[model samples]
Target: MKCLPSSLLILAVFPLVVVAKRRRVPFMNCPSTKSSSGLGMVKQARSRIECSVICLNNPECLSASYCKSSDGYTCQLSQMFLAGGCSGLPANGDCTQTFVVYPCENGGTFFHENRTCHCVDGFIGDYCHRRYRDCQETPLGNVLYTIQPFRSDYTFQWKCGPFTSPYTRVSEYASVFNFNYTLTWEQMKQGITPHPGFYFTGPETLHQLTKQGVYDLFIRMIVLGKNSGYVIYKHFRVDSEAEGYACHWKSFTRYYEVPYNSDEYLDGLGALGDSTKSMKGARFGTFDNDVSECAGTHNFAWWYNPLGCTLVTFDPDGLNWPTNRTGTVEIEKIDHTLIGLRNVYWYVEDDLIL
Candidate 1:
């Protein structure tokens, strides 16, 4: 076929972009422990002195009230104005809210302000969107998936997502899992063309798994609730030098690119929670072509898509696991003009547990 074009490939990628989109921005300034609904939640500081508990302690407390009898004060959280304060205001101090704290990849806690929380890797915005593709947050729920990663011929850093298990397959897109020690090169070669669950980094050139041998991949995503399962998106034939030149993918990165609007894959989570499964059934996406490849392989890599869906995934936490989840995929046959090979192909690999 056409050897990937030059300059055009490099331009395929640009700096990352992050924006803000929420129903009403559920922010709070009071310590009432109730979600801020933009309405009057806190009774309003009964007296100016008790306001300290609501205002002095948390600068975000724009309004407050006192339970004259309970001897306690409740603070009404104001709209989180610019991380710290509103423009020109005297600036009370740091009013950053401290709620469900999760550990970011590197060695820090996720960022939280104005209600929306995200990772700390230079990412600042709704759901941690403003950062390199490698910086998106990977919500590992309660299932506690524990598995190691293996490589084919070539591999890169950002290309690796946390795999709770390793799998192999044979198809045009490679759909089935062969695991390790059970398949041979001839078996793998004649097995499937492209294995399912294939994901890749954002690069201009195509990256082929530098090593063309048997490789297993372990991937994990944050699934909410007990039997909920998240789609595993992993890239294969990656880390190859020639593939890099072909795909022009140098800075490998992946993001949630999840679709939140679909019925198949929805973020079932109820917005905020304490544990991964407590994610409240946050959906990930639908099994549509956006999440499939053999169908068309449209690069719908971002999570929380405007049209995508999310669902409660198999709790990766120790409490619950997807006992009924199953994977569905398409298997097709194609005659790749370049290789002069008429082969049955399978793409858009996915695993779903009911």
Candidate 2:
């Protein structure tokens, strides 16, 4: 035997080298676990890539099966290649479906069993490159109250939560009533104005009071995105005449400067200017004079006096009297307290009302 030429020897060695190099095929099915007639044996690998690396490094490994494990992945090195077909190995209860590991583009994971790429949370699209916002319920502001003489109202503002967008359709219902009457569900539905309920299109919204009464308000928000929105409820009370003052005269009096039966008096014993009196009336015994002096002497005095036949005269000097009659009348003032709200109810949807 004689040695071959250098060029021919190099060509022969190149084919052998090519045959020894490992081939990687994505989504190829293989035995998920170690079996007698399937993959020869199982060895631990840190990840799916490590499993493929294990097969590439082994001269006898014609194919590989990668299954997720607590430590990482279990690499089943097979001596046979099924060419993207299912393995005939007995199914292992603890093993995941087997397939060839491939690179997942854009921070995604290629699921060997499913042969699909799965993006992490907050990401979407074919390559997991697009960021997506999750839908959420908007938060409601504090309820504000407005009072009137015969009615009152309330208001609130709200907007979509973080990474969420408002939907077109929104619904609201309120159950309003007082101690004397209750606003029925049908009445509430009738109160919803402008058709199709409180549908809104915006990132933020303000809910104004259309009706006046003490009631509970329920708002249901529908949002579209990665998540569904939520329903919120609030209670409010409005009252008229919740505060004011009540007043009346305690005591009043009138006085005369001239003597009784004086000729200078026009309509009475004294001129109107010369006479002084309380707007209301004087207290008993506030003035001086005898009861007999007033009897039949003056008809106005006889009928107008609180004492009647026992009438008393005005102060003689017009400066002092039996009682302090120069002071202003004292009044008793008070504030009105609000009444407790009764029979409160909240309805999220029309059918929920009762």
Candidate 3:
């Protein structure tokens, strides 16, 4: 038999693996409720499912109200959400019904009976758009909105896992962050490109630094199928705009320390920082754009270093924890991360961990 090339042989041995897209049921039936808002596009639909299909086709359509009239059935698409309680539908019973169309964020469960979203542990708000941190403060606009603030220190947890390629399409392996900010999938589709790793937007990160005084930054990273982990518990201060959303810290304290002396170990995050390597200035990188160098090669975004040695990452292959510093062994992969940030002056503990 003719010999096949090594590359072809390898391909034959292991067939190409394909990832399937996730199925999304975007709407749920609310038989007892109808939209209180004005009518939108009125169309003829055979059934409520057809009305849902019509609403699904229109990206701007938030909900669809189907009414049974003497002539026939009419499908009315509206941008207003189908909230709970009666909508004054003339008490016609099942003659009129509404379908709420939207995905709840952060692994929230939508209850069709009341049109309410029961959010995950760390998130709250109507659509679970806001973090539980919002419960800490009372807004100026409303007095009734005032809630009992958390009296003592608290912690919130969010878990991120590995996801396969293509990243743009929603999959079973995709990570849920917030509202439309679902990591890996929705972000790529919405023109936001980043690896399926934990990250905070530049604006959000900057907002946290706006509070004056020292802040305690705590990061806990656990390897999958392992008992041990790494933790960065220290105090830091941010010099806003000093770098591309990168800040400075007082000490590099961690549960597991790097080798005592190793030339390969440049800094905490390799050559990402400025010339001084004090983390004074650094820029983030994405797969499309290599602002920090080598980010494109990894097919992920981060404060990368051309020289390697990554301190923290949610990427399975990108978590280089510095065993390579002394040429002992390769850095292990990190699969889970929990981050907490708190201002020294303020008594609140904010969970900015993605």
Number of the top-ranking candidate, with TM-score as the measure: 3
lDDT for model 1, please: 0.24
Q: List, residue by residue over 157-209, the lDDT tens digit for candidate 1.
A: 33222333122211111123222212222332212222233323322111222
Off by over 4 Å in 1: 1-41, 44-71, 80-82, 85-354
Candidate 1 lowest-lDDT run of ten: 5-14
lDDT of 3 by residue, 1-354 (tens): 111111110000011221212222333344344432347788899876666556655655656567776789887776665543235543444334443443356677765433456666555555554443321231222122212123313222212222221111111112233223223322332223233543443322322432333555554444444443333424554333334445555555545444222233223453333344333334445555455444545445555543452444334333434333345544555444444454455444322111
lDDT at residue 215 of model 3 (Cα atoms): 57
Query: In lDDT terms, which candidate is top?
Result: 3
The runs of at least 3 residues in candidate 3 whose Cα sits more than 4 Å from the true structure, single-residue gaps closed, are 1-203, 225-227, 237-243, 255-280, 304-320, 323-329, 346-354
Q: Could you tell which candidate, 1 or 3, scores higher by lDDT? A: 3
* Order of quality (lDDT): 3, 2, 1
Q: RMSD of candidate 2 to the true fold?
A: 32.1
Kindly list the per-residue Cα lDDT of model 2 for residues 1-354, writing each as its tens digit: 011111110001001122221221333224344332255779997655555556655655645666655776687776664434455755654443333333344567644332345665444433343332111211222211111111113322222232222321223211111121122223332122222222121111111221222233222211212111221122432111111110113221222323221121111111121234221222111113212334224321111223332222222111100111134221111111111111132222111000
Better of 2 and 3 by TM-score: 3
**Model 3 pairs whose backbones collide:** none
